[model samples]
Target: MLEQVANGKLTKWLAPSMRVGWSMVETVLLTAAAVGIGLWLRPEDPMTLDADFRWILLVPLVIAMRYGGLVGVWAMLCLIGCWYVLKTSGLYAQQSFPEGAMLGGLVFTLVAGEFSDLWRVRLMRADSAASYSLERLKNLTQRFVLLRLSHDRLEENLLTKPYTVRDALFRLRSLALEESSDTALPAGDDLLGILAEYCQLQRAALYPCRDGVIDDRPVAVLGENRPLEKDNSLLAYAMENQLLAHVQQEKEESYHGAYLVAAPISNSAGKIIGVLVVERMPFLSVNFENLQLLSVLLNFYADVVYAGKDTHLLLERWSALPFQMARELVALGRLREEGKVETSLTLFVADDSEQAGLILDALARGLRSLDLAWWVSDRTLLIMMPMTGVSGLEGYVLRTEQWLQDEFAFMSLRQAGVRFFYRHMDTRSTEVQLAELLEAGGV
Candidate 1:
């Protein structure tokens, strides 16, 4: 068995490397065969120089089409080596090199190689896009399933439960915000309790994790607490894949272990900072919808934890700023600092006039779903567009102007008594920039 495994591993490793090896081998063998045919047809000029066509050029052309530019160049070098061998061996006494023929062959080989490379790059890009889309589809499918389940539960318990999930989430957010800084997880027990109520858990534990290591001690427990197993298969799988794993999953059948559910608590940036391990739950709750809901709730809590540190201060300073906008601003600031993404902030201030208010209202309604908008005042609106660069901001302004022209017959925003200010999120402090923007807008 060990021998078989070793061979399997070796095969996997060599599979990708073998393509280049085969290309080299084919280049050598085919070059030799072409030279052999030339020698057989014309012993004096083995390269078939006197022929109407230098057939040896086909070798590099074929290799270029099969492999790429570098390997094709190697094939041309092989042909040159064969020519040197013939000349040095006294079989051919040609002093002048066939530079013209060689150059033309190289040009054709490069053209073919370039064509191959272009398509290869396009194929790779297409595959990457498809993979990203598929991942998004999977996430949306899970959320949809959870939403349907939550809707059904809401209808069934409309009388008993006076609040919807949205209200519960808002309350949870408030609870998380009110948590003291000393604790690793803000409102840990409350979070677990809420999860138990929704996910129907009898026994579960929330374990704080850092840098992919799960702590043995539970931050919160629903029932009798138990030590986390260091080598739990479900935990390992969930952590490795950054996904929720449960007994019902097809891949978990072989090694379900002592836990019924294992889910990673990932922040907005998809970093796992904690793990949720459920030991006892209703058998029916082990299904997909409940598990998905559990995962979603954990993710929501994780996002709150991730953004709470920065947003807390912002919220304290700006009482009127929406919590969601504050969170997104903090996230965008971090992203800008890391040089991972760029975001734009557009502020629209309207004069205290009826027409300006109408234009501002129209602009508010026209904002994209990805954009976060906040009305700093009755006539002042702040919009944050994520992943939009300076050029995107310019385009957005032009589009908005054009839209105003068509919709309200206004030639320009200024003509409509609307003033706009734009700023790109840079490495500077977000709070300082936000203050500067608010001050500029006379807030």
Candidate 2:
């Protein structure tokens, strides 16, 4: 919705008034172009209107079809009226036609042109409104399906401690891999399962679209039907650039059929998460509404994944965190990638009480942002040190421990096992070190 077109002098001068004001200008310009072309085709004296002028009549027809449906007809009428008035007064002498036939042709042509434009406007509006309504309906259905899946997941949690969404996804990957390892299907994805359940596809195969070729590697059967890898893959380009590619139907082959429709699963802010492909029986095509429905459904699938991650579990607390924190976190992520700065991993622990919450928040405010990660357990809070490795962590640990002993030594947390932990995370997790710290603090 927010687009910045960078070039063109005419574009620049008209940009501010373009959307609303430009439509009328377009109508006028089109009319002028049509009339000018019409005059070229049938140049006549001001006094004459000829039946041979039929070729030029097409000019008005083209204009009416392009813009200003009813308005175009009215303008043409005004042009004819001016001509007739100019001729009748002897200010101009009208040329001969088979006189009555000329009058008859003029009447017939004017009425037909008037209604032709009206008919076009009606058809276009109807087509547009109908398509829009169908699109909205399709989206609603897809969201309904996604919400239903969310509800099913929630229901499972009622009777037992449910896995987090990330765990569920990992489990799904394992299951998919196991099932498809023997079969000619692709592994490590939950997409096909969702597609099978909803769209009732016979079997959906996810093909790797590299460059301009399709690589069909169903279920870890890599290079099964090898398509040449292009220097740049088409799918990758579409994804990185935020665009869509036309669906390609498959010819008779040993591969699963064409992805009848494909869309990039995008986050709420419209970043591509992954691609969703829906395949179906050969020779079948989806209507506009159904296609829109599929689009909405796939997007909803992406939303639910995010919901299961942070939203579903920590709605209240997450909501309470200022939006600024989220923005800063994203900035930290970008900075960390460039590898310019260093950070130290630290932990914050407090009794599960209001006072502890306040201190943890204050600590959050004081800490420098980095491309970092953090975790909050029942009593302990953890922050990731993307800035530093093991060597930098030792001094930070000692100073931080002493600082905590002085800072909150008066509060219940001091006696209540308030502690901090610093662990150097190499290529592996610092889980064991965290456990030792937690145990030492009797947490």
Candidate that scores best on lDDT:
1
Q: How well is each residue in 1-443 modelled by candidate 2, as lDDT tens digits? A: 12434443443443222243554555556545554564565455432245545443443454443443444454455445545554575534645333553344445556654665566567569868989999999999999999999999667543232223223222332342321112322342465554443343443345443343444443321112233222324344446554433344222344343344445555333545455444443233244323433444444344333332223223343443333223322322333333333334566788667767766665655553332334445556656554455665665555554655677664333553556665443322223333454465555
Model 1 lDDT per residue over 246-324, tens place:
8766364477477888889876556777898889987766765566557656766775566655677888999899887
lDDT of 1 at 277: 89
TM-score list, all predictions: 0.41, 0.24
Model 2 / residue 274 / CA error / Å: 55
Off by over 4 Å in 2: 1-53, 63-73, 81-139, 158-443
Which structure among the candidates has the greatest TM-score? 1
The TM-score of predicted model 2 comes to 0.24
Q: Write down the TM-score for model 1.
A: 0.41
- lDDT at residue 242 of model 2 (Cα atoms): 48
Model 1, which residues run further than 4 Å from truth?
1-165, 176-182, 250-252, 308-324, 328-349, 354-378, 382-443
